[model samples]
Target: MVEPAEFRSYYGRPILKEPAWKQPDVPLYLFLGGAAGASASIAALADVTGRPELARAGRLVASGGSIASVAALIHDLGKPTRFLHMLRVLKPTSPLSVGSWILSPFSGLAAVAAASELSGILPGAGRLAGAAAGLLGPAMCTYTAVLLSDTATPSWHEAYGTLPILFAGSALTSGAGAALLLVPSVETGPVVRAGLIGAAAELAAARHAETGLGLASEPYRTGRAGKLLKAARALTAAGAGLSLVARRNRAAGAAAGVAYLAAGLCTRFGVYAAGVESARDPKYVVVPQRERLRR
Candidate 1:
């Protein structure tokens, strides 16, 4: 059995420290950012294919989501005005740095696309803006995985490959949440279904990766992080299964959407928490890697 004392430091300090970051909001921002980016991409595709309604809705959601995501990110930074300091240099090893650069252009393009649609400005320009916005969407949605994976966090780095898929699923769920909140059940039904599929994919990938990761992965399956991961799995699975039958039921669809969103939030938070836990316990970083090398 895992004991609390086993996770303590030399001074009897809790070996697993809480992240300096606050909870809930940061993960929420990640979800929103992914959704916004994906929605923009989907909307651009619809526009190009002549699905005007889908295109319009996608663009609107994309714009709103992106803006909201940016706001959340800035707010979480504790100094919104100094956010630009993040872009002072380019560092390939740093996911946050790369993300800042990506966000700068992606957000601008998304804003332009949204504005062009609203103002009915230069029809030709709309196509260009839409296309650009759409292209950046997938990248925005999935890059968070890279950000977390680049860290020294054992749980995160050990599950590097799965992180991208997890982030993608979270992004899809965020978009589905927005769709359920804004669109009618009939129209948003497909979005919910898509989110379900994404969530399932995420859960499957995480589970498989976790099992193969050895001791470094233990934190993800134990303690507070473990509890959150279990909850996410349950909620996401239940929500996805229900989404199929809830296609025409507004209340059911709403509930499913909420569940997906919650699952996504829990996943990010759990991963973050697990990382903190792993970092505090030196054995997590040293033991596993050393064992692997000895093999």
Candidate 2:
């Protein structure tokens, strides 16, 4: 068997640099962005299908979630006043810059949709805004993966293709969480099903990221990041399974909904932590890619 490569820290200090952003705001943005985007998609579906009430509710949730996500993103940036600097540069290679561009238009459309819905002042504007909101929603929901993937972190960069899908699934699950918390059982049932499917997909993506990525996935399989990933897998699986039977029991539905939400949060946190770890370990960055090149 080949011996695992050894790594040394820079100057005998820690190899990985600590993440500068606060935990709460970053995770909150992940949750809210997912929720908003999913809600908008659902709302568009409902509208096209002639379910006005469901459409309206979806629109409201999507709009609120998007607005909250934007705020959370700004808060997570240490220099809130300089957040706009992200927009000044159109660097396609920089996930942060790309995300800023995606977010600006999406947030504006969400605002218009929300205001039109609440004020009833714009004739036919609600429909147009809703359409625009729906378009931007998915962009907001999945771009976090790009943001993380663009970084120097080995684990995240290696899992770039899978991250967007995982984030999208998490977004759908979060939208279901909001619906379960706010909507009636009659309406929330389908949302719960949607959430379950999304959760399952997210879990599968994470697993694939871990196993298919080979050594790069070490950060997700060991230490603090590993623990969180394990927890996320367990919670998401349990929640998705339980949601299938939740229609028979209100308590089960509520529990599953809550579990899905928690699982989504955990998944995001774990991914973030894994990135930090991957960045810290030179072995993670150098060995795997080097091996790939050698092959």
Which candidate has the top score in TM-score? 2
lDDT (CA) for every model shown? 0.76, 0.78
The TM-score that candidate 2 achieves is 0.88
Residue 73, model 2, lDDT: 84
In model 2, where do residues sit more than 4 Å from their true spots?
A: 1-5, 13-19, 246-248
Clashing pairs in 2: 16-280
Regions of model 1 farther than 4 Å from truth: 1-19, 122-124, 189-193
Spell out the clash pairs found in candidate 1: none
Give per-residue lDDT, candidate 2, residue 101.
87
Across 31-149, the per-residue lDDT of candidate 1 in tens digits comes to 77888887887778667666676677777888887788788888888787667898788888778888988887888888888888888998678768878988888889888888877
Score every model by TM-score: 0.84, 0.88
